[model samples]
Target: MIVKRITNVFFRYALRVITLLFAVSVIGFTLVSLSPVDPVQQYVLSVGSVSPEQRAELEDYWGLNDPPVERFENCLSAILHGDFGTSLLYRRPVIDVIREKFANTFALMLCAWVFSGVIGFILGCVMGANRDRAADKILKRICLLLCSVPTFWLGLLLLLLFSVWLGWFPIGFSSPIGVMNSDVTIWQQIHHLILPALTLSLLSFANVALHTRQKLIDVLESDYVLFAKARGESKRQIMKRHGYRNIIMPALTLQFASFAELFGGSVLAENVFSYPGLGSAVSAAGLNSDVPLLLGITLFSALFVFTGNMIANLLYGAIDPQIKESYANE
Candidate 1:
C-alpha cells in the first residue's frame, strides 16, 4: 500500500510536469512564431551583406521556410533529444552556451540563496521571538518598506555606494579582466560576489522575515506551545523543539520559492553588474531577437522552478507525517 501510494504521488507530479513543460513550450514557440523579427533575416543582416542564394540557404538550414507548426514540432523533437538548436547570435549550440553560463548563474544563485535564507531566517526568528515588542514592530515596518522598493533600483544603489563611491569591491562580472595574482584568491572571488548577492538578498530578506515572523507567531501561540510555557519550559527549549520544528516546513517552502525567484530576479542584477550569468545572456538574447537562446533560457528557468518545488514538497512530506499520510490516503 505504501509503495502504491508513493508511486501514485510520483505519477501525479510527473504528469503535471510533463503537461506544464508542453504548455510552456507551445506558448513560447507560438510567441516566437508570431513575432515580426525573422532569425534568418536577422542573421543575414548581421553578416553585412548576403546574396539571395545565401539567404535561401540560411532559411532552409534553420527550417525558416517551414510552416510554423512544422517548425515548432521540429524544435520540440530536437529538445527531447537534448538539442536546443544552434544559437543564431553566437553561432554555437544553445546547450553549450547555456551550460557554460549556467555555472556562473548557479553559483551566484546559490550564494544569493544562502545570504537571503540564512540571514533572513535568523533575523525573522528574532522578530518572531520578540513579537509585539518595539524592536519587532520597528523591524517589521522597515522590512515592509524595503519590500516596496524596486529591486533594480536597490541593485544600482548598492553598485553606486559600494563599487563607484567606496571603491571596495569590483564593479562587474564574476572574475578579473586579465590575470590572477596574489590579490585574486577565493576571498577575492567572494569580494566580487558580495555586492550582487547582497543586493538581491536584501529584498529576499524582507519577504523571508515577514513569512518567518508570522509562522513563528502561529507556532509559538499554539495551545501546545502555551502548555509547554505554562509547564515551566525554558523559552529556548520550547522554541528549539517545538516552535522551530513547526515552522521549518513553511520556512522551507518560502526558501524554495525564493530560490526560484533568485534565478529570475538575478537578470536585473546581472545586467547591472555585467555578471556573465544566464540572466545577462537572456537579456541580450531578447534584445537581439535571438529567439532560440531566449527560449532556452526560459525553459531553464521553468525547469528550475519546477525542480525547486519538487524538492520542497519531498522535504515537506518527510518533515510532516500528516502530509505523507494524506497522500497515502488519497
Candidate 2:
C-alpha cells in the first residue's frame, strides 16, 4: 500500500510538472509576442546610436530576424542547452544574473514563509478554538484591516516607521558580500532581515490566518469532530488528534498556494525596499526588454509555484487516508 501511494504521488507530480511547463511556455511566448518592441530593436537602442546595417547585423546575429516559429524553436533550443542568452542591458549572461540574485530572494522568501506559516497557524487555531470570544474578534478585525491595506503601502509604512523614523536597519539590499566572520554578528544579520521579511510576512499572515480560521471552523463542525466529542474525548485530545489533523491539511494546501503568491508579491516589495533580489532583477529586465532574463525569471517562478502545489497535493493525500482511498477508487 505504501508503495502504491508513493507511485501515485510521483505520477501526479510528473503530470503537474508537465502541465506547468506547457502553461509557462504558452504565457511566456504570448506575452513576448504581444509586446510592441522587438528584442532586436531594444538591443540596438541599448547599445547607443547604430546604423541600419549594424541593426540588421545584430538581428541576424541573435536570430531575431528569423520567422516567428523559427525564432521560438531557436529560443527553446538555446534554453534546453542551458543558454539563457545574453542580456542586452547588463551585457552579461542571463543565467549569471539570475544566479547572483536568486539567493537573496530565496533567503528572504524562506524566512517570510516560515514566519508567516507558524504565526498564522497558531493565531488561526486560537481564533477558531475561541470562536466568538474577544480574542477571536480582535484577531479577525486585525486580519481584515491588514488585508485591506495594499502590500506595497504596508511595506512602505513599515519602512518609514522602522527604518526612516526609528533607524532600526538599513533601507535596502542584502548584507555586503565577502565580509569577515567578525564584522557582522548573527543577531545583526537577523536584524537586517527584519524589515523585508516582515513586509512580506504581513501579507502572507493575513491570508493564512483568514483561510486557516475558516477551514478550522468547518473542520470543527464536521461529523467526525462531533463524533469525537460525543465519545467523551477531552477537548484537548479531540483538537490534537482529530480537529488539528484534518484542519491542517487544507491549511497546508492554502499555505503552499500563498508561498507562490509571496514570490509574485515579492517583486513589488523588493522594489519598494530596493532589495537586490530576483523580483528586482525581473523588473529591471522588463524595463530593458531583456527577453532571456524575463523568460528565465518567469519560468523559474512558475516552477516554484507548480512544485509547491504538487507537494501540497501529495501531503494532503498522506495526511488524509480517505483522499488516497478515493484516488485509488478513481
Candidate 3:
C-alpha cells in the first residue's frame, strides 16, 4: 500500500512536469516564430561586413529558407540534444552564455530566499500565537502596505536609500560594467550582493509571513491542540510538538511556490539595481532580437520555476500523508 501510494504520487507530478515543459516550449517557440523582427537581419547588422551572398548563406545556414514546421522540428531536435544553438549577438553558444548568467541570478535568488524565509516564518509563528494584539496588527498593516507597493518601485527605493543616499553599497554589478574583476574578494562579492538581496527579500517577506501566520493560527485552535492542552501540555509544548507539524506543510508549500514565482519575476529588481544577472542579459537579448539567447533564457527560467513547484509538491506529500490520499482521487 505504501509503495502504491508513492508510485501514484510520483506518477501524477511526473506527468504534470512533462506537460508543463511541453506547453512552455511550444508557447515560447510559437511567439518567437510570430515576431516580425528578423534574427538574421539583426545578426547581419551586428556583424557589420557581409556581402549579399554571405547574408544568404547565413540565412541558409540557420535553416531560414526551410519550411516553418521543418525549422521548428530541427530546433526541437537540437534542444533535445542539449544544444540551445549558437548566439549571433555574443558569438558563443547560447547554453554557455546562459549558464554564466543563470549562475549569477541563482546566487542572487538563493540569498533572497534564505533571508526572507527564515525571518518571515519566525515572525509568522509569533503573530499566530498572539492574534489581534498590537504586534500582529502592526505587522499585518505593514505587510499589506508593502504588498500594495510595486516590486520594481520598492527595489528602486531601496537602491536609492542604500546606494545613492547613504552610499552603503556599490551601485552596480560585482565588477565595473562590462569588465570582469577576477580578483574580487569574497567580502567584496557579499558587499555587492547585500542591497539587491535585501530588496528582493523585503519584497518576498510579506507573503510567507501572512500565509504561515494564517495556517498556524488555524492549527493552534484545532481539536487536537485543545486536547493536548487539556492533557497538561503547556502552550509552548503543544505548539512545539503538535501545532508546528500541522501548519508547516502548507506554509512550506507556499514558500517554495513563491520562491519559484519570485525567481522568474526578479528581472525588475535585478535590472533596477544594475545587477549583472540574467535579467539584464535577457533585456539585451530582446532589444537586439538575439533569438537563441532569448529562447534559451526563457526555457531555462521556465525549468527553474517548474523544478521549484515539483519540490514543493513532493515535500508537501512527504510531510503531510493525507496530501497524497487527498490528491489521489483528483
Candidate 4:
C-alpha cells in the first residue's frame, strides 16, 4: 500500500512536469515567432553578404520557408527524438552549448544560493530574537537598501570597487585571462566567481532574511513559546527548541522558490560581469534571435523551476510527518 501510494504521487508529479513543459514549449515558440529579428538575416550579416540563391538556401535550411505550424511540429518532433536543433548563433547543437554554459551558471548560482541562505537565515534569526534593538534596526535598514539595488548595478559597482579601484580581484569573466582553459586552476575560477556571486547573494538574501524574520517573530509570540517562557526556559533555549523548528521549513520553501528569481538575476549578473553562463548565452541568443537556442533555454528554465518546487514539496514529507500522511491520503 505504501509503495502504491508513492507510485501514485510520482506518477502525478511526472504528468504535471510533462504538461508544464508542453505549455512552456508552445508559449516559447509563439513568442519566438512574434519576435522581429530574422535569424537568417542575422546569420548572413554576421557572415557577410550572400547571393539571393544562398539566402534562399539558408532560409530553407532553417525551415523559414515552412508554415509556422509545420515548423513547430518539426521542432517538437526533433525534441521528442532528443534533438534540440542547432543554434544559428553558435552553429552548434543547442543542448551541447546549453550544457557547457549551464555548468558555469550552475556553479555561480550554487555559490550565491548557499551564501544567501546561510547569511539570510543567520541574520533573520538575530533580528528576530533581538527585535527593536540596534542589531535588528541596522539589519533591517541594510536589507531594505540591498533589496532596492538592481543586480547588474550591484555587480558593476563591486567590479569597480574591488577589481578596478582596490585591485583586489580580477575585473570579469569566469576564469583568468591569458591562461588556457585546461591550465586554469579551481582557485582561479573561484576568484573570478566571487564578485558576481556576492552581487547575487546580496540582492537575494534580503527576501529570505525579511521573510524569516517575520516568521520567527510570529513563532516567538505563539502560545507554546509563552508557555516555554513561563516554564523557565531561557530565551536561547526557547529559540533553539521552537523557533528554529518552526521557521526552517518556511525558510526552505522560500529558498527553493527563489530559484526562479535567482535565474532571472543571473542574466543581469552574467551580462554585467561578462561571465560565460546560461544567462549570458540567453542574452546573446535573444539579441541574435537564435530561436532554437532560446526555445531550448526557455524549456530548460521551466523544467528547472518546476523541479525546484517539486523538490520542496517532496521535502515537506520528510520534514513533517503530517505532510507525509496528507500526501499518502492524496
Count of clashes, each model: 0, 0, 0, 0
Q: Which digits, one per residue and each the tens of the lDDT, describe model 4 over residues 1-330?
A: 889977987999999999999999988888888879788877888799799999999899878889999998998999999999899889999999999999999999999999999999999999999998999999999999999998988898999999999999988899998989999999999999999999989999998999999999999999999999999999989999999999999999889989999999999999999999999999899998887899889999999999889988888887977887777677
Measured with C-alpha atoms, the lDDT of residue 74 in candidate 1 is 90
How many residue pairs of model 4 clash at the backbone? 0
Clashes, model 2: 0
Total colliding residue pairs, candidate 1: 0
Model 1 lDDT per residue over 1-330, tens place = 888877877998999899988988999889888888578776876788999998888888878889989988899999999998778888899988899888888878888888878877887899999999998999999899889988789999999998899999899988877755455677666777888888878878889989999899999989999999899999999999898888878988889877666876789888988988898999988888888898998888888888888888888887788987776667
Instruction: Highest lDDT: give the candidate number.
Output: 4
Candidate structures ordered by lDDT, highest first: 4, 1, 2, 3
TM-score, one value per model: 0.91, 0.90, 0.89, 0.97
- Model 4 residue runs over 4 Å out of place are 328-330
Worst 10 residues of 4 by lDDT: 321-330
lDDT of each: 0.86, 0.83, 0.82, 0.92
| Tens digits of per-residue lDDT for model 2, 1-330 | 768967877887788787777678777977898887478877777668999998888778877667878878888878888897887767899888888788878888889998899899988999988899999999999999988888889989999998899988777766635677468676766666778889899988888888888888888889988998899988899889987887787878888877578987789889988888998999988887888888888888888888787778777776778987787776
lDDT of 1: 0.86
Comparing 1 and 4 on TM-score, the stronger one: 4
Instruction: Name model 3 segments beyond 4 Å from true.
Output: 1-16, 49-57, 176-180, 323-330
Per-candidate RMSD vs. true structure? 2.4, 2.7, 3.0, 1.3
Displacement of the residue 303 alpha carbon in candidate 2, Å? 0.7
Candidate 2 achieves a global lDDT of: 0.83
**How much does candidate 4 score in TM-score?**
0.97
